[model samples]
Target chain A: MTPLRHVFFVSDGTGITAETLGHTLLTQFEAVEFKTTTLPFVNSPEKARSTLDFINFIAKDAGLRPLIFSTTVNDEVRAILRTADALFLDLFDLMIHTIELELGVASTHAQGRAHGMANQQKYNSRISAMNYAMEHDDGQSTRDLARADVILIAPSRCGKTPTSLYLALQHGLFATNFPLTEDDLEQQKLPSSLRGLENKCFGLTSEPERLSQIRSERRPGSKYASLAQCAYELRQAEQLYRRAQVPFLNSANMSIEEIATMVMQEKNLRKPTF
Target chain B: MTPLRHVFFVSDGTGITAETLGHTLLTQFEAVEFKTTTLPFVNSPEKARSTLDFINFIAKDAGLRPLIFSTTVNDEVRAILRTADALFLDLFDLMIHTIELELGVASTHAQGRAHGMANQQKYNSRISAMNYAMEHDDGQSTRDLARADVILIAPSRCGKTPTSLYLALQHGLFATNFPLTEDDLEQQKLPSSLRGLENKCFGLTSEPERLSQIRSERRPGSKYASLAQCAYELRQAEQLYRRAQVPFLNSANMSIEEIATMVMQEKNLRKPTF
Candidate 1:
């Protein structure tokens, strides 16, 4: 058997993307055993030095080709890693060329210029909120909820939790999402917790078919998973938003990033990370 | 009131970056009111046309400068939006130039090239798993748990959820995370559901100081928020991983992306994106 391959993911700020992309790459080689490590939030040269030292340690005994997935802002730091005995791939390298060609602009060496450019803080916060909501679906989100910067109201599976968390991580916004449960739907009013924050309210609507497809992935064979039921709930949810005078967006084809951005814009919030 | 400055985020697959950047830019102008909308997964010419139509509709009524933040693979499609009356900000246009200069390489324009090069699917899975773990903090992941390509184990506030979600959104891997609760700490055994899946296990550890700082944000004055306690738990968790022979990564400074990438590489996954 081939000795387990080792790969390193180096990041500029949070290391989230490097790890995410790296994990996907690893999944393709189920047969090859490998070892992996990440150096997160490597924002400075000293941190980069530490990362390089660690990489050297990993490469010393490993016989196979070491792979690197990195998003580095510092050329000096990236230069140091170029010397590593490994196959290196970085997203910054891939995207910069395209950006220059399209915009007819030269590249700048400003650090953190691209850092918050993607709304990372809001993205992280919303991701956190989504994870929090999913784990805490016991109806506890209603109380002590002032920390929530925005509350998303939508029927089941309209991309609520994911959007919320995206807002949190990308903007440092505390986002909370409440399902317009059947009772809220029947009553056709916003959730009781969201009543006073109408100015901060935004809605996500999706085509019933799309919503059904996503729901099917988690709860197949349930009424919620059926196209008909999904359609009904979506329609009810849309009506609720309309009656409640809340601004809404259709998430039928939007990515989580897009959803969070739209909500932030609608709420007129300027996120910290981007 | 100044007409809300309108910003449109158009993306190739998921309009995440476009929207996120757009949201951040809106924040720069404190005096101006702003409205934002995200067009997600707009990877085709037809979608671009529809997006243009929407822009036209908004322009007719809003009479404001529309900022377009776009991420596109097809140059032709991206060009269609150039006619918009608003200040257009294409995400690819901004970053590509910088990336090429940094890497000293011209990129090839191959279809689906971006997906494989960046390895987004794996990150998506990690994000999904992180989201699942956050919602299911009671120490249970939903069905399809076995599908996780990699599982993360860490104590509370150890950056497990963010790392996992980053993996999911970016990489599309089936990543699941389990928190090392007090019970697990005392028992020093894997979760009952995770016994047979040891081959897929990876651990995230952090310096006690870092963990304490993170937790302090969530709970200000409590025993659980004590730095001393955090240090003890981290030590105990390290011992547990050592005894189980589960390889671990210290996330004291790693970004979420880096951690996911390391896990992917360690697993020896073949393709960049599954």
Candidate 2:
């Protein structure tokens, strides 16, 4: 195996986009091996000094050269990253250049101001709408909930939280979900909040055996981890959804991306431009 | 403003990849207005019939021809999509051809299997390994946490789930996260589950004001949504992280793509090639 190269993500704020682009670019080169670690929201000179010290330690090892992808809000931090020996991809530089070329606007060099063209008013309004919906939700909000762009109703352990976040982050959709409790199954009703918004909701079900296996790994000996309970929950959740007119998807066979996209498309939601 | 053109995304399975690529491409064009919708996981002729009906509804009053980016798994579904009088980009054709050429694999006429990669064994193993970690984890699992490809720890209402999924789906990293709860905060401890994994643990925090604002939208009137409580949580979580030597990112300002990329670089994770 090729030795792993250590890469550092130095950020002015959150270093998410740089890391994503960097990761994808790394995939293009199969000959080199890499191991990554991130330092996010690094906005201080002292932090930069410590980061440099860490880089120096890695450099002393001789085998690994640190690669840094930094997102910075401050010029001083950027300057610090620039003086480092690692290969640094500074997003502030890229965004400033791109913005200058695209819109003919000189960058202000002010902190926290950079690239991206989304209309803040519209984006904020959309988010506010979801916030309002979430706040107003009742217990019925838990079922075939229509106020959400995508509603993920799954039993415990079925990856609901991650899937919702993926949809929100990647697609910029207002995705929400609720866990399908036994009460929901016992009542054979979607939580009351979902009554009017049934068409907008989706379900995520996993194989009972798979869920039981997963639960067993966690709790080991609890009644909650029993295969029989898992089967019951799975069957009852499906029945409730079917009666409620909420379409469901099996998460067992799908990745989070697939689930998020499917729900986004089903609701005529716009995918995130970024 | 130009009237929005009807845009459709038809996919064989979940329509996630098609929508992802289509939306990214759409972002490149600002001159045209688009009204987008998707038909997901349409793998059978019956489903194709419904998709066509939906297409007709969208196109009935089209002054300009609609545009479609379709990834079809079924030949019959592809044929149906071809009959629509829209400017369509057949994505399945493009990607399958690209993959086959890159991997030297013969393309098969299989339904609902457009992106079933030839290296299934390797991909499956990676997924299983990550899933296993998720299950075995108990608010604690200290095994070489520092050795993790990427570690994500975010408080409730921050966009951890979406970011983690994007990292996993697009980049193929074994990413796992745990919530930063009140208990973890009061104790000033990284979950006992994450105790020794300090080097591997990355915290995701947001401005308490921003987080409270976010949570209030979801659960108004509850203590969980109180700005004061949120601020306290944010402060305590950061303090705990500092004491525990865990690095963290703020989620308020970053997009999901940015967060995923940031994590990928921090962990020195890899993306799949073929």
Quote the lDDT for B212 in model 1. Answer: 84
lDDT of each: 0.65, 0.62
lDDT of 2 by residue, A15-119 (tens): 544454344334433555566766765768888888888877886685545677666656787788777766666645543454334323354444322223245
User: What is candidate 2's lDDT per residue for B1-274, written digit by digit as tens?
Assistant: 6566787878766565455445544543555566777677788888888888878777787766677777675668888888876766664454444433432345555544433332446545555444534432323455555545666776787765445545555555656667887887887877767655677777888988878877886788899999889888888888877887776778777655556656655655645333
**Residue B199 of model 2: what lDDT?**
77
TM-score of chain A of each: 0.58, 0.64
TM-score of each prediction: 0.62, 0.55
Docking quality (DockQ) for each candidate: 0.11, 0.10
Write one digit per residue (lDDT tens) for candidate 1, span B1-274: 5455566767664454454344433433444555666665666778778888889888778765566776665777878887777666664554445434433445443322222223334434544654554544434655666677777888887767666665555555556688887888789987778888888788889998877877886788777879888988898899989989888989775545456656766776424322
Alpha-carbon shift of residue A143 in model 1 (angstroms): 1.5
